[model samples]
Target: MLKRIATALWGKFESTAELKKFGFLAAIFGFIIGTYWTLRPMKDSIFNAIVGMDYLPWAKMLSLVVIFPLVIAYSKLIDKYPRHKVFYILISIYACASLLFCVAFLNATLGLVNTVQSPWRLIGWAWYVFVESFGSLIVALFWAFTTDTTKPDSAKRGFPIIVLFGQVGNILGPLLLNARRLGFANSAPVVAICAGLMVFSGLLFCKIT
Candidate 1:
């Protein structure tokens, strides 16, 4: 019975090994994409709250300015090192940055730092820049890894299923946020959760074969 459902949903594989591999890769890809999607709304909301909708154009432009050079550097790194190593470096940096922001924002919420002041606004701007840049790069790397790892045949069958998982993540992220409105109210915990998802997805990425 379950086999029928599995086959109906994911299609049949020639062997158990193929089935397992397809599921594994699909899961990793889905989580990676989902994690990024989750951050999308959070970042947008925080940017709107901190700087107002009027300033979003300027923030996006600034994000492009910051991301362009980093993208070039990342492309060069891909040429110089193994892709997995590059993934590790990038994800680690993102995770650490998230943790730092989590701490900073938490302090601000607790009155350890003044959030209604100049430096706080500056920090919010920086967060907006990082979020925009990271969103583009992470999604690009995920698809790149997907193409690199998936056989053409498997990808044709499996990519859609993987994307479905990502869609679930996309739906789930916002629902989770809505449920945790208190976290979203401040932005710090939201950033922390996004960071944790990135780290978790990175671990899963490492395990992909």
Candidate 2:
């Protein structure tokens, strides 16, 4: 039964010209939530541990000013490359990118630093920045790739289905993220598994796009 559900969940988007666009716009919302929701229950614990209550709002301010804008700018930067140049490399790059995001998430959750004043503490927060920033970037790039793959008319249909798959991931990811507080020592491994799932999703997006 699990195999059957898995098989059904992890399949290519069928090439129906009419259905491709369905997933396009939905992909954005799907992925935004997917990244956000992936670490849901433990978000506060992780944030407080790394950035601390004193620092989180400031960090969020920094992210809004720097990380968030860069993410948008990077998405628009897609236009800089010759359109045809976005090929197999996007997948490999995104996979590597996803791995980094996961590592960042794990490091933040572990608070693997001496103290808030330690240089290592900055590194953990930096990882947190990267995880949140790049995770959104990954989703944006995924849709951009899909738009490039589908015909202008057909994309409207397929996009929704694409988002649907990601939405499933978003909803399910939080459900699975419940292991965060078991022990600090084990946090990285669990986050790594979550990251692996993210990368696998990236691979699927690459395959279908």
By TM-score, the best candidate is 1
Clash-forming residue pairs, model 1: none
- Estimated TM-score per prediction? 0.85, 0.62
Q: Per-residue CA lDDT of candidate 1, range 159-208, in tens?
A: 87777877877777766645266544565676777788778877876666
- With candidate 1 superimposed using the best TM-score fit, by how many Å does residue 176's alpha carbon deviate from the native? 1.0
lDDT of 2 at 134: 53
lDDT (tens digit, per residue) of candidate 2 on 107-185: 5343434234432456446555655565555555655665666775555434545667677767766665555444446
> What's the TM for model 2?
0.62
Runs of candidate 2 with Cα error greater than 4 angstroms are 1-36, 40-43, 72-77, 80-120, 180-186
